[model samples]
Target: MKLEPHYLKYLAETQDKDYILLDLMANYGNDVWNFAYFLTRSSDAADDLSQDVFLSVYDRIYSFRGECTMKSWILTITRNKSLNYLKKQLIRKILPVKTVPHGGTVQSAESQLFDRMETKRIWSAVIQLPRKFREVVILDAHYGLTDKEIAELLNISQGTVKSRLHRARTKITVILETDNEGE
Candidate 1:
């Protein structure tokens, strides 16, 4: 089996744990973090979840049979881990959890506030959607993953991805419009 060149740089299924980890971080760290953040909408949770994902990946590496691309598999693990994290959060249910932004800004100050508010509004609307719809919206709309790629990452059919995306978009539109009516 010809190894994917991208995977070759970071993983070979024959390397030591450290090398595997280094490769995973070097190649997919941001993606894992982004995936986690989009799902949890909590940067801190995303950081923790990203680490958990890699740990799980290391523990489960041997089980990977190359049934899918390495990234897809890693993302699948991240998705599962995020879901688990969400479940744990629900159980641990405590005081309000706040997601603080770290730093940096590219837009002008005036536009930044509006942009942030708009982004927050959209995110709030997205969060209100069902989990399946939310995931599809983030993966396809925010992360720019293709429907086929999302299907593979989500372990769902492409048609399902398409349908969910459509439903999500419709719900989001209605949500934003309803909010506008109030304002």
Candidate 2:
């Protein structure tokens, strides 16, 4: 019988303990946080969701069968947690709110202006997409996951992923064009 790699053997050996799991969480913390932030668009919510995702990963790590990279597996968990958080917020009518303080000077006003404009353009287009299409766009564009990876993560067919991505791109383009027409 051939032996597995040292890391996999180590992982399998220590997979049951909380500290080892904490190490995994620490290693992947930033990746998970960034993914959540991209999905939620709120720093506070993203932070909380990242923690929830790590908890879920810790609980479910034993179920990992090495079919996908650990990072992909963790991302799948993060995506699910983010969507669940969004759904709960909608149910509670606690949608994310951004507040600007009065009389506060923003450093680099010109850059801030550019950022605001770009964000408006991008989010306006994205917001027009239906949930299924928007999710694929977010996961692919923001998180840089391949279509096959997304299909596995989403448990959907590759054709479905491609279709949704195509629809999302067309919707975004239409929204941008309409905005340009108004301008």
Candidate 3:
């Protein structure tokens, strides 16, 4: 997407202003939400996280140095927010292992059923991976982010991203193939 000069000027010069920040959020909101959804595996959680990311972006817009595109910056925020949310969920699950309720009661019954059938089989396999590997898989396969972009967002080396992604794909592939054999 070509950045309009006026937009660039506004971002570069007046990004601290609320209206400019709101404009940026409006333009990139859907993209951020999609990225968050791909990471979270829940549309409702993605919606909440996307809103949080945009709020963070709005507050931090003036800190942008144009080192990367606005999309990348926004995606970085989305990734961080999603990761934080995942960590919180994991902690909650771990802490309440005995107390947490487990049953077949789902608020979105229709959507849950559809999700079970239509969900990417590979993603279910991917989730079985350790967190680091799962992250690489989600960023690469699910979100279509390049290794360089993933590295930039995750603040890691490109080689690390490549290795993790390779390992993740192999693990997920094995899981899927094994499941297929059992079925």
> 1-183, model 1: which lDDT tens digit per residue?
223555554456466767777878888898889778767767788899888989988888667677666777888888998888888886322222223233565778887777667777887787777789989987776666778878988888999999999999999999999999999
Of models 1 and 3, which has the larger lDDT? 1
Local distance difference test, each candidate? 0.77, 0.73, 0.71
How many pairs of residues collide in model 3?
0
Q: List the candidates ranked by TM-score, beginning with the highest.
A: 1, 2, 3
- Rate residue 64 of model 2 by lDDT: 66
Q: Estimate each model's TM-score.
A: 0.75, 0.70, 0.69
Clashing pairs in model 3, backbone N/Cα/C closer than 3 A: none
Error of 1 at 174 (Å): 0.8
In candidate 1, which residue pairs clash? none
Q: Write the per-residue lDDT of candidate 2 for residues 1-183, one digit (tens) a residue.
A: 112244356567774557757767777798788677656666888899888887787677667677776777888888888888878785322233232222446759897776667666776577556668877887787667788888999999999999999988988988898888999
Among these predictions, the greatest TM-score belongs to: 1
Residue lDDT tens for model 3, 1-183: 323456568877763577876787788887787667656666778789988987787787667777666777788888888888987875222110111122575659787655555354655576567767877776776456777878888899999999998888788889988988998
**Whose TM-score is higher: candidate 1's or candidate 3's?**
1
Q: RMSD to the native, candidate 1?
A: 4.3
On lDDT, the stronger of 2 and 3 is 2
In terms of lDDT, model 1 sits at: 0.77
lDDT of 3 at 128: 67
Q: Is candidate 2 or candidate 3 better by TM-score?
A: 2
